[model samples]
Target: MKVPLEIRPGSDAGLGYVKYGNGPVHVLVMHDWLGDHASYDAVVPWLDGHALTYVFVDLRGYGQSIALTGEFTVEEIAADCLTLADQLGWGRFHVIGHSMTGMITQHIAADAPSRVTSAIAVCPVSAAGNRLSPEALTFFASTVDDDNALRRLFKFVSGGLSDEWADSKVQHSRATVAPACRRPYLDMLVTANFVDDVQGLATPFLVMVGDNDPGLDAKAMQRTFLAWHPNAELHVIPDCGHYPMQACPRYFATVVERFLKRHTT
Candidate 1:
């Protein structure tokens, strides 16, 4: 089902969100850094018949929230998700965070343990943060101005998807984001750390990684999430890269559905 986008007051900005399904189980899906709620479009059909309610949200300066502005830090983003949940009158719910939002999910689970039922981090960045080298940071900063470079960067993330897909992703991102939000967020995601913040977090976690995803693999999850959370479990999706949901939507949805059924029931 389609719902009109509603803007809710976030910490220092406004967040836009849309809800789907009518199941009693409530889930909040956070978008990746590259795209907004639309990033999960491929998985929608798979969830269309499920007995769950899924809410897809856009961070400030992205998608429907493109006009909104904020600090864009992980902490602020996590707060926005909680605020949305409150607005929805959901006392507790599950969170499915992809890519950068994966990191944001940790903040949500860490900050409000009692409010979160479970967390699914799909191709997520660990809560401890991903420290990048000065050279790599410089290169990422450059992509803000260079579309071709940005497209090429996604190639690595997608493990070499078709040109059409890459172009569409680049176009959508450029149209929806401003450099002010993009640059600072990139800086934050690459350098921020929260090892102590998430220590001893008991929230049930389902960490999904793509076998072809270069940086965030099963091994990485083992070291970061598995080592940190005693209740966390990792699953590897084969023959796909960072965007497994997009690469194989049905399979991705099936895996997530199974996990939620097991834990959220």
Candidate 2:
């Protein structure tokens, strides 16, 4: 059973979260782009007692949470997450973020080393010279309007193994909350940057990527970026895609469980 919790940052804005297990350390889990806390759905059940408490949920503008007033920037999302942590009384916790959220997790770690015990990013978005394929850019352009019916071309661009998964992730993600989240989020993200210096990263770090991910080079990138950190490690999942949370959750869960047990003091 999932225990639901709500964090109201202010007027008209709230974030939804779930707490699983009971342990000395709590985990602040972030989802990939176009995903909610549900991104961790497949892996949560198995976390049981091993992790003490595993917290995963939708951000301010995704899933059941309401976006804040005015524009929603990447910084805003970051602030909201930190605020949520404070509200939950998690002065210190482990963080596990996927994709865009992984980037944010690093920001948090850099900003507050005392509060973060460890960090994990599964296929983190590129912070430096990140380039999308021409095909991907074209597909993103075509998805500007939500059509009455699903488009096959869109499914191909979104990186799902099946049209069903692609459509569901996109449609639900787009329709989840306020539109400001994207405009501001994108603006802030494009303007800001990330660097993978695990040595600099006070928290122990774990980075994982999937074989099906275009280029499947997240591991290489992680290694190049995090090589300086003695505690940094990387893993590449075979026969999987960008959506490894749903694609091969068993491996995902194991990696997370091990990271937590070994690092968290």
Candidate 3:
């Protein structure tokens, strides 16, 4: 029988998180631009509670932190996560970041190398940042108000998975994310670049990308993350898209656990 997770709400200041497990190895999991900590709900049941503890956090203006506001920069997000870890009394931890927050993982690991054990980036935007054209930037910015646009974007990234899936994700984003937080976050995603800061760092990174995810595919990982971090490794999930934890929970959990196990010691 599968073990039930020991879940708890964050009581301390900084980013709000839902804590799971009671294992010795600590991990901080952050969400993408689309959803909050709930984005990892599908993968929770498959995670190894006996070996690892996870704290799924809500960035400013997202989920439990919806009332918390900030400058909405990746640096600010990284700092909030570190602060939360300090409050939780964790001196060292691993970080798992998805999409936008994936970039934050790099920032955290580079800024505080002694504290971060390793980083797992899922369909991550590189520390170099994703520079979009003016037209593309305008379309992404419009996602805050245009549900259809956001839904279409989700569908495209997930390799046209299904309309139902796309719709669900769009609805989740609409409900959990603050509208005012969207544009500023988008600007941060497009403009933030700190590749120079993370390059040559000794931190180990497991950069995962879905083969079907056109935007952040295996080729993109090789050119950016793998090229920048000397200790980085790449994994391509077959038949998956942007959201592996959501699209292939069991397989995603297996891969993530394998990586964590190697570094936990």
Candidate 4:
């Protein structure tokens, strides 16, 4: 069954989130750069709700937290997530982060290793960051307001997926994310480096990437996530690109749940 989107508004000190399921396992799922929590809507129906509960969170200036603003740094995001978890009365929980937020997951785990049970990073930017060149950074920053540019960028990451899909994603992003937050968050994605904080982290991590993802591919995972964490494992989803939750929801849920279940005990 499709889970209803129930938005929980944030307080002055917390981020807003959508709660799903009533299961034993608690999971905090964070969205990527483009869209909000709604980005995971495609995989909601396939989720094993009977065994797992998910809290889909909106970062500052996104979705339910659209009115909120912040420093937009990884440390700030990690702190916000921890604050949200405490508000939800979750003592220890699993975390799942997609794209840019995936890097935040590392920070969360590092900051509170005892509280985060395990982490799943999907097509994530590494802690070392993308380190984009000045010109490339300018090109990406320009896409914040340009629909066509955003669509083209999504298309490339999705391995030349259909225009219809890219368009839908762009529209969703425009609707949910505030334009002012994009550049600041993009700056963090391309330049922030905190590999030193997370290196040798013992918290288990499932580093998942789409086989067709040209940027954060399996090889990239090997050199970054897998190399930095002692208890990390890599899984490449077949016939997929950057956004597997959108492109292959069923399989994505299955893989995610399987890993989550393994560490639940």
Candidate 5:
């Protein structure tokens, strides 16, 4: 049975989080660019609360942290997560990041190697950055202000399915995300290259890719995350798109929990 997660207010400098379970292993979860903590609602129940404590956080410009002001850069977001952990009195914790936060997860692990025991990224953006055609770049850039465009982009990314789901995602993101932070974050995910920073990092990483996530295909992942990090493993979840936590919650949670169990100290 799944226990309810507790909503905890964050500090002045950190983003708010939903705390789940009371296990020895601490895990910080970062949502994707288009979704907030609510994105993990389905997956939460399937997680092993007895073995892992999950902290699902909203990025500085999204969810409960929308009011907080910041540059919304990957480094800044990583710092915010670290600050939240410190405020919670956690010495060391595992990190899980979805979509854009996945790339941010890499930064967090590299920035504080000793503090993060292991990291997991789900349908993550590559740490090396994305390569988009000029037209594609323009299209994505324009979605910053247009919710309909954003919804269309979501559908395009999710393999042309789940229109209603994508619509809800766009609405949630538009309402919760700070308008100023959207484009900057998209720029970071597409242009910020951290190859040198994460090249030889020893922190273990589990990269979970939804088989249907057109953006992060097997070859793309191999060329980036798998190639850049020394200690990393990849798992492909079948019949899932860019948002596996929403499309296949039970499987997603199980895969993540199993990886954590293997890596837990």
Candidate 6:
């Protein structure tokens, strides 16, 4: 059955959302900056089987959500997130943020510790030593530039994935993206605090990343997080990249299910 989802105005942050699920635990699933609800299509089925409710949010300027002009800080997004949850009657819930949205999750965990039960930051963006981290920047610049290069890069990075698969995925991403929605998400990163933000956060956490992911120094970030907050655990999915939920749904679901079960209230 399709769950009823509605758009709720954020007053300041443009478009906000509210959706309901059936399980005792409610999860707010935040997508990568470029993604929409469709991004979860691969992982949702597995998540649905776990018998918990899920709320997938389209961040400001992405998908059906509206972008707040000028003042687009992560705090604004985070505030809208909590407000939307309140509007949905979710007194306490869990959050799972993927890719860039991981930054938003950290802001929430840091600011509203009492409302969130647990958080999973999946292949999240981290302190890159420098924003111009040459290798990582090259990966992103290619995606935003050369089409053929994007395909080759995808194949090279995702590893174990065939040429046909890589080509199709790249095509799908390029074809589906909203040309107008493409822009900066600096407010999000800024509001969340980069790299060392929310050290030793009290919120129980899980950090999952693909073995071949190049978004950040995955191993180093994981170690830094654990050193600061002893409550967090890390899971590395083999043969995957930044988009583990889509590239390795089965593995992603299993990891999430186990974590949710152990932490579910």
Report the lDDT tens digits of candidate 6 across residue range 1-265: 7654444543453354444457778888887755565577777667653367787776666555644443456667688788768866888888988767776777788778898889898877642222445675556555655678677766765645777877777666565444444434632442344446677778888888787876444665555555655688888777777777778887788889889878977
Give candidate 5's root-mean-square deviation (CA, Å): 1.6
What Cα-based lDDT does every candidate model obtain? 0.84, 0.65, 0.89, 0.91, 0.84, 0.67
Provide the TM-score for each candidate, comma-separated.
0.94, 0.81, 0.96, 0.96, 0.94, 0.80
Strongest candidate by TM-score: 4
lDDT of candidate 5 over 138-214, digit per residue (tens): 98888998777898888876754577888888888888888888888888888878878888788899998877887
Off by over 4 Å in 3: 1-12
Q: What would the per-residue lDDT of candidate 3 be over residues 18-78, giving only the tens digit for each residue?
A: 8878789999999999799999999998898877889999989888888787799988888
Residue-level lDDT tens digits of model 2 in 90-162:
8888888877676777777777778889888777754442355677544544443443222554354235577
Residue pairs with backbone atoms closer than 3 Å in model 6 (clashes): none
Clashing pairs in 4: none
lDDT: which candidate is best? 4
Candidate 5 clashing pairs? none
Candidate 5 — number of clashing residue pairs? 0
Model 5 local distance difference test score: 0.84
Model 3's C-alpha root-mean-square deviation from the true structure amounts to: 1.6
Q: 2 or 4: which has the higher TM-score?
A: 4
TM-score of 6: 0.80
Candidate 2 CA-lDDT value: 0.65
Off by over 4 Å in 1: 1-13, 48-50
Location of the lowest summed lDDT over 10 successive residues in candidate 6? 186-195
The order by descending TM-score is 4, 3, 5, 1, 2, 6
In angstroms, how far off is 54's CA in candidate 4?
A: 0.1
Q: Which is superior by lDDT, 3 or 5?
A: 3
